[model samples]
Target: MSLNRRQFTKLMVGGMASSLLPSSVLAQGTTKNNIKAIAFDGFPIFDPRPIFGLSNTLFPQQGKQLAQLWFSKIFGYTWLRTAGNHYKNFYAVIEDALIFSAESLKINLSPNDKRMLMEAWLNLKVWPDVKAALLQFKKNNIRLAFLSNFTEEMLRRNAKNSGIDDMFEFYLSTDKVQAYKPSPLAYQMGVDAFGLPKENIAFTAFAGWDAIGAKWFGYPTVWVNRLGKPIEKMGIAPDSTGKNLNQLVDFVLT
Candidate 1:
């Protein structure tokens, strides 16, 4: 293919720029980075798929729909409570969402079923890619913490279940500020706990909206798009995005 003079100059400049970065940095983008600490949203670290699997096991007919609605309602309540100043803890919000989902689907959820479903959240394991990435982060001296909307009790219980509780240096639950994410106060927990600038503290978000929230608060954010979802049309984007923790490790440690 032939190139116009302007196109040729652009290609030449791009080539020169690409040469200056490490291979991983080239993929993450051209921006120079200073990410010293990473603040992770809980779902990215703990595999929540098992909870959905249990829903399927309990209600074979309505399980898929129930799980989707319940998942959506969980975040819906968080945003609603934040806006209305109702301020329910995440665990309560989750239980409320589950009940609403079951009732809406006309599924008669037994007390034992409900108990088992909620308990699943407390016994989650990390995703397959999580341990290697976490070990690398620890090796690199990159400080780590949880910046989740989950209550500290929830986060701690899940971490303990995964056998990785000691991996986190802090748990910056939004419970402390009584605010869910997208609020500046909620994101500020990372900066305060890490005692680092928002730019230096990278936030790993499990959902697109949460990634936008962290970016809006000035954190260089990475959206771990584990479900292969598209980015939200929020007029903002994460600095990097990946399907799992391994890609996140490259973006940060590169």
Candidate 2:
């Protein structure tokens, strides 16, 4: 089911309000505080194959299949209904698909296969743009952090991989909150942890749905498009949109 141009435009417009709320509302609720910190999705910004590369050695057949499935799922290929909606991680949503795809092919992933995949997760590579962008933010005195759905160990490894671990004042995972994004609790916990109000923080993400959630929570939002796609159907436009982290820095620092 491919969306035609009309359908795509409708999707983008219908969700524009949620993605980009009126500036009046934002101003009414806005405080004078500068952005205190930043949060990002680790895997989407970085290449994830190396982590999954190790998955191949343990499961051999199954591992290779799951790795490919994960990539296809995240990179905009169509798949069957996933359990969670936009809030689920690319990997979690595909776990079921991977299992089903494997079973249909009569492949069974052993426990060791799973463990090895988990190990692969710790070694994700940061996108080339990430380090320079974070350094720019740090130079401007904005606190930086990661708020992700990954577990503590996974987040740490991602930090090491990105080489921006030192820039992050805190590394938050969904395990600590027991919920995912679009859940006010998750975003709230992020705001509370930094002891800042929503208006004071700028939530940066490539995910349009996540940006919508952050906007609904009253944070100034920036969408890093990376690709020049229309904003998702989130009923609001981001406060600003950018092609990369450097663009985001320009938006924020300006």
Query: TM-score: which candidate is best?
Result: 1
Task: For candidate 2, give the lDDT.
Answer: 0.66
Most lDDT-accurate candidate: 1
For residues 1-254, write the lDDT of model 2, one tens digit per residue.
99999999999897786568764345333424366567666543566657566757656766676666655554332123222333444346445545554565566667675555645666677778887888776766677767765666677777777666677888777656656666676678668778877776788776677778778878788887765677778578788887778766766665
Residues 1-254, candidate 1: write the lDDT tens digits: 99999999999999898898776455335424767789999999999999989999999988989999999999999999999999998988999999998998899999999999999887888888887888888876778999999889989998888688999999889999999998999999999999999988889999999999999999999999999999999898999999998778777777
The positional error of residue 226 in candidate 1, measured at the CA in angstroms, is 0.8
Q: What's the TM-score of every candidate structure?
A: 0.87, 0.67
TM-score between model 1 and native? 0.87
Could you give me the TM-score of model 2 versus the true structure? 0.67
In model 1, state the lDDT of residue 204.
Answer: 96
Candidate 1: the clashing residue pairs are none
